[model samples]
Target: MRIYLPTTLALLAEQHAAGAVLVPDGAVVAEDDSEDAEYAALMTAADASAVQLAGAGRRVVVVADLAAEPAVGAAVPWREVVAVHADVEDRPAGADPDEDLAWFATQEVPDLF
Candidate 1:
């Protein structure tokens, strides 16, 4: 199952160093394999990321695939991360949170920070 983990850049850096990001329960999960479903999931995750942002920063979503549905408080290993979706530029304060995110490959994750 694919999971979208809402997170912040600071946290992302920590995760990068730690090699895994601990995920909370009830994270975004697509209902089906359809593109629309996955998109909805990503949007939902972006919203959740906004809430967590609480201040100036771009939205971020960690895309990872797990063996099965994740349990409560699961940890996503860095190796499991396939891609990252984040704002190409930091959104201005009070800017539209609906701004789209850019896709970055896992190898490019280090350059994101």
Candidate 2:
């Protein structure tokens, strides 16, 4: 299953680290374009195209700003869309650090001599 992460640099990095593809949103597309016409056209088409691309059974993770929620809501099917709040931290603090240490311990024997 492929996950499509929207254009938030931090989230994109995090998702990519977690092995997901970074999908650019309308705003990102618009910002990338130099010509006004091209920007407008892409902005208009982005949501629809994104939704179409994220058809049934595909896992789409949309990391859009709060303002973009309404636009995303209209285009993407709710069931397939996982909307992550932009303000929310990518990885919340207090994640299980002990689990990581335990896993590392198994990889190499401790020097108990």
Candidate 3:
């Protein structure tokens, strides 16, 4: 099962800390017609590409800002696409780090097969 993590650098770092393997190093382009048209175009292209790739039994996991845009939960014929919301404040400073680490150690990311 291949996991696709489309997120920002900061969140990618957090995912790494959480032991998410094979996380692609990239940013999730936000859609904006006026301020970020280029980014929007890039996102559209990425989404289309993902849709195609998903058909080949690859698991696509989109990690985006949930508050910004909720990922479309549509039915796909040959793939399992899961979206995980990136929580900026899920980890607090000066907190018991091991406690938070324990959660991810037992958490299931999902199985594509």
Q: Specify the highest-TM-score model's number.
A: 1
Q: Between candidates 2 and 3, which one is better according to TM-score?
A: 3
State each model's CA lDDT, in order. Answer: 0.84, 0.31, 0.33
**Superposition TM-score, candidate 1 onto the true structure:** 0.91
Cα RMSD of predicted structure 2 = 17.0
Model 3 clashing residue pairs (backbone): none
Candidates by lDDT, descending order = 1, 3, 2
Candidate 2's C-alpha runs over 4 A off are 1-5, 22-113
Off by over 4 Å in 3: 1-18, 21-26, 32-55, 66-108
lDDT of 3 by residue, 1-113 (tens): 22224433343345545554232433344444354563453444344333434333221234322223223332122222234322223333333322211111112333211
Residue-level lDDT for 69 in candidate 2: 28
Give residue 34's error in model 3 in angstroms.
12
Any runs in candidate 1 off by more than 4 Å, and if so which? none
User: Between prediction 1 and prediction 3, which has the larger lDDT?
Assistant: 1
| Candidate rank order under TM-score | 1, 3, 2
